[model samples]
Target: MIRIRLGARGLGGVRFAVSPVGAAKDLLRLVGFSPGTLTPQWRTRATDALSRHRLGLLAVVGGGGPLGYAPDFIRPEPPAFLTDINTGLHQIATTPQERIRYELAGAVNGHAWDPGSGHPPPRQLLRALDRGEDHFAHRLADEMARFWHAALAPSWPVIRARLEADVTARASEIARSGLAEALNRLAPNLEWRDGELLVHMRTDSIHQLTLDADAVILTPSVFVDWALFCAGEPPGAPAPRTPLIVYPAAQADCLPPAQDHPLIGAMRRKLLAELSQPRSTTELAQRLYLSPATASYHLQILHRAGLVTRTRRSRHVLYQRLGGAT
Candidate 1:
């Protein structure tokens, strides 16, 4: 269990940010062995891509081994909402070597893998860290950039829209209710009371964090499942300057089980299949060989049934499937 004691000013200091790098890191976690925790639909989508690019990404981020720790450098906290992949790559490239080394050492030491029992860190990676080679960091960053472009870039638009929607919904919750109410709703294991935020972690140990004057950055993540993760300075270190709390985004409810129900027609089934990612009406019309008006009509029906959601992006309005619709 982790308990965070917030000062009187903590409530006013809360802020929110969206990080592309963080999302990419979460994707790494999703592709790991524990992906079974993910929705079956999303797991299938991610695994299909992983099979195609397994060899290329394997060298950098090893297989789903017991000592599975992607270098901590890849998970840098963004100072602001990351607008593009290039900006996030730049952040990874420019991270101070000292910080990178510190985080890497911590990951290695804190890992619970039995020595020589499971896949170990890549030989090249171990050598690079031992010899303090800067090239290794650059190579890791390059590989991450390549993986992002090939595997995740295609789905980024939909992912970003979902993240943005979550932020807007959270802000509305804060306005309608209050900060405490919003915080409690973030996850089942979180509670705000007595000027402290309590998080029930899987572990039995109790850890307390004090946020005296620093604001906690609440980041909504699509790939984070189960428990909330707190990122801040290591225990007993210097007072934390910037702290982040990441919680899972609310997923759409599971698709209704009556697939062959009379209410669901052929067009609605096609729309649901294509909605794995968000699409504008024009895009849907072009792909489905239907007129824009027809596509819009079906979309409205799907929206009413709570099977999909719509959001306006600039001049275009996009719709995406909710939950794990088959």
Candidate 2:
């Protein structure tokens, strides 16, 4: 029972992000490191890859950290938008030695094993951390980058679509009902009451705290399934500037709405071809000689099919083809 009391700054400061690093980390945990369960295809892919090559440092901290504590330094602070995995890996690679020492300490400690797991904590990289080696951080980042490309990249578009769809829906809810209302309904284990966000913990740990960060990062994960996870600089732990909460993504509902819309018309086909680069509907409309309404209608169909992804840039929402994988 962790009570995250949100002040006006915290409530008004809430933001949502689609984190590739987060999903990738959760996938690693779900498949082999933890009691988590990934969807069949994801489990098979991740498991096969893990069996083939040893991730060394990544496998050490893949579940984030030790004692069910995921370190904050590994994943860069998400900025309410989607970015490629390299952007995040760079952040991890350049993490300061002091920060890494503070955060990674708990992960490498001998007492950090999961309770029911038959195996001990992964501690092969501890000697490097203990020796105050800056290269250890880069090595960790390198392993994560390799693991993500090998195991997660193939299906990232599918996962990205699911994450963005959830964020889009939740953002809409925040717009309509206000952030307070949205928080109350974010997950089964969470509720924003009065000025506090109550997290019903699966563990017996109980505490009262304040949500006193610049922004609350809400990322949705397909691998997390029905679980709601909250992490921050808890109690006396190394302080993280922003608190993070991961909710279950709406995977089942992410795709196929455009199936009913269908990709039949010549207009849609042409519009899809034009979206190879990001373009606002107005730009697309003017280029194609179609009305903005006609352009938007077709673009919406393509977006729902997961073939294109839309992002708000300045005053306009730009759409780009997500790759031909769909």
Q: What TM-score goes with each of the models?
A: 0.70, 0.73
| Model 1 residue 260 CA deviation in Å | 18
The model with the greatest TM-score is 2
The list of candidate 2 runs beyond 4 A from truth reads: 33-36, 64-67, 108-111, 114-123, 130-133, 206-211, 227-231, 234-239, 252-302, 309-321, 324-326
Question: C-alpha displacement of 36 in model 2, angstroms?
Answer: 6.2
RMSD of 2: 5.8
Task: State which candidate has the highest lDDT.
Answer: 2
| Worst 10-residue lDDT window, candidate 1 | 252-261
Report lDDT (CA) for all predictions.
0.65, 0.68
Off by over 4 Å in 1: 39-71, 111-124, 130-133, 206-213, 234-241, 252-296, 299-326
Model 1 backbone overlap count: 0
lDDT tens digits by residue: candidate 2, 1-326: 66666777777777788888877777766554464345455566676666566776666666644445556676677755786788888878877766676665545442245444455555576665665546877887887777787777765775677677778888898889987788767777878887777777665353345544555778787666444444566545544557777777764322222212345367777786787899999999999999999899988887785668899988989999766433
Full-model lDDT, candidate 1:
0.65
